[model samples]
Target chain A: MAAGGRWRQTLVGFLCLVLPLVSLWYHGRARPTPTLVERGLMRLTSPAQHAMSGVVASLSRVFTDYVWLVGVVEENRDIRRQNEVLAGLVQDREQLRKENRRLKELLRFKGERPELQTLAAQVIAKDVSPFHRVLKVALSAGADDGLERFQPVITPAGVVGHVERALGRYAEVKLAVDSDSRIATAAVGRDVKGTLVGSGDRGDFLATFETLGEAVAPGEEQRPLEAGDMLVTSGEDERYPKGLVVGHIGEGPARQSDLGWVYPVVPSVNFRTLDLVQIVTDHISTAPLDVPR
Target chain B: MSALGQSLSVILITFFLLGVESPLLQELHVSSFPPDLALVPVLWLALHVPPATGMVASLVIGLIKDGFVMGVPVGMYAEISVVTFLVARFLTSKVPIRGLSSLMITTMLLSVLASMLLALLSLLFDPAFQGHGTVLRLAGPVALVSAPFAPLVFFVLDRTDSLFARSRQRDAIFGR
Candidate 1:
């Protein structure tokens, strides 16, 4: 090999080693203080990332809209059938409306608590590694939009996850199904409370609930939690507010011998279809005087 | 084909793959185990191009991947790609992959190695990354899905190179 070629090869090989070591060192840092290099790279790459994502979003919208229109006729037929069924329930709908009004009035009797503050954000991208089961979803909202790390992200149905990383104009949310995610939850109107942990299986949205009690005593049995029971946030940790729906019990309360009972919970929010989500910013207390505990 | 042409083609292919991954693959609802299409070009370049060119292409593609795709540590994928490129370059030079079966096996082996390296890096660097066992379980499936694309990508890249060569020859003949 010529001297110049050999020198170049040596330099490239040295870089091949140094770069990965630098990356590993950066990764090992607890709170990676973004150096000038990272900051500059982020600034340069952020715009390109946003533009690429936007272009992809536009193309997908066009494809889905145009291609999916072909099924409109079949969809219309199904809608007509559903409309006929709905027509027969018109009277029932009226009765239900009256009952709903009464229930709304009764709920109003408890007054409003004003502590909860929320901001809506649109999901722009999702990063799922082929090797790892964890999902990190990026949103349009960021630090400038009052999105902070550890804030709970939710859909109308239930919790999605917490903010994992908040950047200048973008943030990454760690999905609830990620194995590292843990939520404090309880069975609604039941004494059962547990820490719900994600199972890390993509096919299964069911989280495992590890109960906070001793195993059933010898000769004495605990009431097994049945399927279809609602689980809600206990708010004991103050990370999430009380009374928000979490998920529904799926199969168990099966004894784990040493670890009390364990249950599978089907999350209320379907993460596959998530688009728009709200970030909980603050909690306000809304307790009214003379309300019975 | 000229070196510049090859480099441009590689960059274009990498960008196209990134664009497809963001919304198209996710829309297809394969976010859980999306196949690594970008690796096809890296492997192809390593097998066909000069070592220096292949290494440079691998590093560039890896940087693009880290910046654009799943937000991994900056140099993580770059290192993996370079390592894979070097290995593929070495193996092809020594053993000479002869048939489709051998090519497929080579791609699968390289994919598995890349997946394992990525998992190890994630475990070491990504503090929030959990499920070391999950990575082990997924390596095979990821390799399996990625392997089929190798032949198709190689064919396309080969065609592009031939077309570039023909164009250059035509320009030379016409004295343009």
Candidate 2:
């Protein structure tokens, strides 16, 4: 701690600091090969360097696999949640598209015929047993809504039925395929006319085409009521609108039976698959139907 | 301990630290510029020993580092070690060497200064040195990370220096 020793210590530190810069300047100028001391120190430490490299590399793998994978698992869970949300959104989109198409068609059809005021109803249930062909309809009632007795019901496919009774919230319909259902009919591009009567839940769906008022005119297009001929309402019965599709001819030509020609007919609308229908609320008369006896 | 014994022990401790530094930093995924761990003991020697012995030890430790380092010139680290010892000794004199906390803070400060000094010397010496950009890029984060390791390294080196001191004391007592 004497002043001379302190001065010497300070001088030694300064000289030590100066020495390497001088060596660096010389090494830069000479580009000399490493000295014996440098090579000796390298030889001394190389084994330890190699050993630490091997040991620590193994530890890094453990950290990468075990610790880092926890984050990967969390990321995967987030992706799965995103996938579920996307799937539900897609399903809702498809449902909306279908409903949009259906509503657009209904609006167009309503515009096509403005004579009758219509009311919308969802087909809640169907009585498709052998004893009956009735449909249960739930009305989407408006503020001033009311369904009358015997309102003719129709769909985009064609005439479905007529309301048998209005039960305030809903109504039961007598489907066109029931035994008591009747409509004036004529086959397309044919010289014959008849009344289409239903067969009432019969097997094989053999219905209507029972009572022809006129025959094929002297064998002109001899099998006039051929298979696939469309039968449309003639409006002669004061029941359904004219030009409404009632049914189509069955798989065969009409039989020359005693009942003029017993041509098989199938209803245009498939009641089993029907979802929504419209009741022509003011079709026949606003005075209310007699629910024909 | 004798000055020769103390310097040798510093060299021995430095060899292991320089050996472990690269692989350990790589495994720890020390981002950006890796901290210069070889500077740790230079700081210790600066604070503990006489300026002469500490500076010599610093030069030898830097020379040992020259063996492991790839791009740097042979004597550059030797100069860095000597200069770093001088700086650390100056700083600790101004503020007395206290606890591990102060040692860690000083280690961080010294690390950044040493890095800057390295860059400056490289520019003056090695014409191809472009790592002046790295010091600017890291903004001395490598120095920050180098701080935590100081306390542990300081603990180990302190114990080793004390053991040497005690062993020499027993030798003096036995009159050998």
Candidate 3:
């Protein structure tokens, strides 16, 4: 019995040291992929996570619906007042609609992007690490739902992240504000282009743009990038489509890096309140842009 | 309690805590930092359980957490948690920790150490991990947040242990 116990102790000790080292080595490699064990574990745990999220969401809905009903009377009165005002604006709205249709016809505008295929998904869970921020969010849809890894997630506001991993009925999205996340972006209607990387602070989903190109020549006059400058996807990497709203630039003390220039940007999407998002599944190719490489 | 019973209880508690930490506790973010409720139970297990059991419990809890949380490597939290459990176990054995104050102090130190280990490991393994600045900013608040909950966690776990003990005694006396 004593000998058996000693051997078991030795085995356990060996495993304790070996398991973590193996995991570290596997995860440390560039473009690390989840192992079979990881996938199995994800498959096993996803249902539980889904169930927990469902319960919490249900409770929140119940509480909000029942507790906040007291304001319904006042809200109804306010809605009635708003309805009266809206009635007066119906004629103006009809006129504007006619004008908008005429303008669209003149410009030969297609209703929406026919090339891009998108599917809507709901966020199920978020990262708990306060220090790391919400580097990832769990989504309700997964491989079974036509979600694929590296597919970009977005909202009406702007870019959210890409699908990092897709299991049976669940997927993990690597949020745009994660320290590891990078997106190719450019200033709208400007020559400025850079890669946006997350600034790992919580409640502050600010990203810093690492500009690409030669520095401004000494004593050469150059227009400075300013706050509220709209940013859009450059499609240089071919990951995200061009002209998708990325974010707006924020004013900060000018900083320079070997990359060229760095500026802070406020992401267009408010990550904190992300309930629903769209995943870009496929897009038809268009004519490529000429580049001076 | 039987060993199996204790292990099951620990596993159940850890799972529930994992659920709470991610989706539930995250919603109650106070001042940008939510208390790591999972760590509280981990500390309790390490301090109160036998060495082998504690180690197993720590690994199980850590792996479960890794699966649910994102951005970090799979073994990062598990490794840190195992180290924390070992250190806590060693210290408790060497020095008798009495009173709620001492326990709370120990909890704070362990929390800080765990956070630092996480930061260090990220720096070593994750190429995208920036630096120790985020860890430094969060360590104090996380430790402070976890400290107040130590006593509560300890009390609940202690009660659980006692309940199991009592039931076992009753079973033995009844000779089922």
**Leading candidate by DockQ:** 3
Interface RMSD of each: 3.0, 36.3, 2.3
Superposed Cα RMSD, model 3: 7.6
Looking at model 1, give its docking quality level: acceptable
Candidate-wise lDDT, in order:
0.67, 0.68, 0.70
DockQ of candidate 3 (2 decimals):
0.43
Please give the lDDT score at residue A99 for candidate 1: 59
For candidate 3, the lDDT comes to: 0.70
Candidate 3: which stretches are off by over 4 Å? A1-7, A61-111, A135-146, A215-223, A287-293, B29-31, B167-176
Model 2 regions more than 4 Å off: A1-11, A29-41, A57-293, B166-176
DockQ for each candidate?
0.41, 0.15, 0.43
Best-to-worst ranking by DockQ: 3, 1, 2
**lDDT by residue (tens digit), candidate 2, A56-125:** 7677655653454454456587776576567657766986898888788788888866776888887644
Clashing pairs in 2: none
